[model samples]
Target chain A: MITAERKPLDEIIAMILPFKKVLVVGCASCVGECAAGGEKEVGLLGSALRMDARMTTKELETREMTLERQCVYEFIDRLTGLIDQYDAVLSLACGAGVQAVAEVFPNIPILPALNTSFLGQTKEAGLWLENCRGCGDCRLHLFADICPVTRCAKQIFNGPCGGSQDGKCEVNPETPCAWHLIVTRLEDRNQLDLLEEVYAPADWSKKEGAGPRKIVREDQQN
Target chain B: MKIESQLKNVLAAGRFAVTAECGPPKGADPEAVIKKGRILKGYVDSVNVTDNQTGVVRLSSLAACVLLLQEGLDPVLQMVVRDRNRIALQSDLLGASTLGIRNVLCLSGDHQSFGNQTQAIGVFDLDSIQLIQTVRRMRDEGQIIGGEAVSPPPYLFIGAAANPFADPFFYRVIRLAKKVKAGTEFIQTQCIYNLDRFKEWMSQVRDRGLHEKVYILGGITPLKSAKMAEYIKNQVAGMDIPEPLIRRMKSVPAKGQRKEGIKISIETIQALKEMEGVHGVHIMAIEWEEAVPQVVEQAGLMPRPTV
Candidate 1:
């Protein structure tokens, strides 16, 4: 899922300082699952902002709401009526959600309260691990289901570079060496032959094309 | 005349090859590399110029190789994948070939975090093994990765680095075999302080018959001091400096440590010369180029053969 972390309170406070009233919004999708931009987080942020406003200028007002999903237009449209009451919308959503809200209510100031980190997995309650590079092309099967393109620090194709030691990456000792994991899994399955094959250089245009990427299903389109 | 690799020719003639490293300067200064090259000339076969080794910014390996060539030294262009995509790597290979570089060593370079430029993004678009195959394809097949034909192809001796001391030790030999299969003609291993583990890796290479498929050069870096040994053992990733070697270095007084380092290097060279499947010794006298001639001569590897 697309993970995000809340922006520093000071940065969020600074963004909404000019406004007399603000809406602290949240998304109940990936950000919600990570406990970053859920309904509870919205209440926490709104309360904090209200407290800061009361202690400081005592001139600002805040209201909190969480949409089912902020990226989609249907869910985002819920804010069309309530958005006019607030001077700015502080979104506790991923970058996509902030952008979607901005597109829906083009006139209002949509400030992001959270920084989208990565497309990651919630490994545990307090940990999120990046598991994808969104390279546009995937070859997980060739590498024993381990994605070197995403996990390996250097993104090596035929690796475990010399820097790999004790199954740990030299870049970050905390991170397990991706190639070691790939080679070990492949070796366990007696599928080491897969590594013997030299992979061609990736065509990066798929991921880094001329501009933004889009997908359309013509059959489902009205 | 098929390929102009002097290192390959020396190994082909069944003579023990001698190679050493020449790191490019941190700044764009030609004399630094030339000075090092001059010291190593007449003492080694094809000095390997490192490519931004340890991710520190330096004069390019290609440019430094040219400088060494000017000093009447055959240079091995060390190309790392850390800072280049396929296009840049192939372009540099072609440029190196055209500039009279006969040898190229492919490496998935040290991570940028270790260097001064810790914030720099690494561009490992292709790893060392894939780089080897890319060179092979460009040279043998006269084509780029996209099947585009070149007007004239490159003729080069390809090499890659191996680390037997790294973890998953059983797979290190397999990785070497993979490199050999990828068309690497020569392999220069990581510095060997743990001879027992290296010999074990060599045995596995022989078991798989990979030793016969490619010429293997044992890496020999002379430790300048006991502190250096300890630092490498503790701080340097992927290096396997056994405890006894550090203790041995410490056994000697501070003034005599350099001499002890040279002595250990010579002993390693002699041992590698006797080991089966070992074709040469790559003396990496890091920042101590003056010691190469002494180590080579004292180890009875002087009077480098001219192939």
Candidate 2:
């Protein structure tokens, strides 16, 4: 899930302060799951904004709309005719959705109403914690299903660093040492011998720094 | 005294009764819900058990409230008409009454797009005002929506929400009036961080005699850290943190600032308690329920009012 938190009420108010007619757009995908840019948040934000505007003696004509997935072109096309109805759009989607909206409606200003945090899972209900960095490489197989790129303090690719103490990271005691977790998992699976294999430095070319990556599936392509 | 009798006395005495909200658990675990109910039992006259709050699936508020009632706590079963139609709402209401749940907070819940189940469809057959009216019809007229005489209509202390800080401030007062007209006996507003603005709204309510008809509870939540304060300020709608308060939050070092957060919360409660037209503080510590007792104590309020 794309974890996002609501943008500050004042910041949101300032973003749409100049607009009379505004549409609060909610994404029904990742942001929604994180409870940030979902329909409920849209209503809450819209209602809160409306209340704030009323308190300020300003009249705001606010309407709310939620798409199945804001990142998809098909969903973006849903707002084609409705584009001109609002002065601006407060997109409650993730960064991807916001960009998608901006790409589709070049004329309208698309404002993000949420701060896209990171790729995370719900640790518990109403609580989501980050777990992945999307480093564009799948090294979980090499590390017994743990991604050192995200869990490690220094993003170490090999064995535990000196900062690792008793299976806990020294930088933050609450966080477990990623290498320790890897070692424990490898030991459990009887694959501790894999630790002997020295992996080369990560190839940055195949990662995000190389630019936008693409996957072409001949079976699915027209 | 029973909450109803106390409420009546408070009303006659021209004082406001305080109420707070508690969202039910998302799963079968009732520990959090039970603890919240117990924590708020004597501190608040009524605790609102939100029904699948924000459209998120949870243990039914009715069931949670039943447990609270068993513990000798007053539970206000918050029914969101967004998911349930008239039939289900009425059935739940009558069922609650039969189970001795006397308070209810009617809301048009968050749309299904906000919950774990995005494909879920919303059933907003009635908005909050309409739900209040429906409850009133059932209570006062002893008639259901179908006009059939309900053998015994449920008597409930109905509550609703008012966002004084909602944009277009004029509409806030207008909405409150509408809710009152529709049968809201009490209103628990969104978080109150901007007391000046809240006071202005209260003055308007007072001038319009709206305060006379309904008790108002101020919603408050303590910031656990500067980051949390920033989050609430930026992300949480209907929540406003003044610059001074923000500065105070920021002054505390990140490592050991939880104590500072508690102090800030205590101060907020103390200030809110002294504010005119502010009946009581609804401490929404969110996950910080343990600090509520200290806040109430610091604010010089008895955990339970002797009156």
lDDT of 2 by residue, A35-141 (tens): 88888989999999989988889989999989999999999999999879889999999888999999999999999998989888899988887788776778789
lDDT of 1 by residue, B101-131 (tens): 8999999988899999999988877888889
Where in model 2 is the C-alpha error above 4 Å?
A: A1-222, B1-16
DockQ of 1: 0.74
TM-score of chain B of 1: 0.98
- Per residue, candidate 1 scores C-alpha lDDT tens digits across A19-125 of 99898899999999998999999999999999898889668888899999999999998998889999999999999999999998999999999999998898988
TM-score of each: 0.97, 0.56
Residue-pair clash count for candidate 2? 18
- Writing each residue's lDDT as its tens digit, candidate 2 over B144-199 gives 87679996898787888777765445435756777787788878877777878888
With a 3 Å backbone cut-off (N, CA, C), the pairs that clash in candidate 1 are none
Superposition TM-score, candidate 2 onto the true structure: 0.56
What is the Cα-based TM-score of model 1?
0.97
Give model 1's docking category.
medium
Candidate 1, position B306, lDDT = 75
Measured against the true two-chain complex, the DockQ scores of the candidates, in the order shown, are 0.74, 0.01
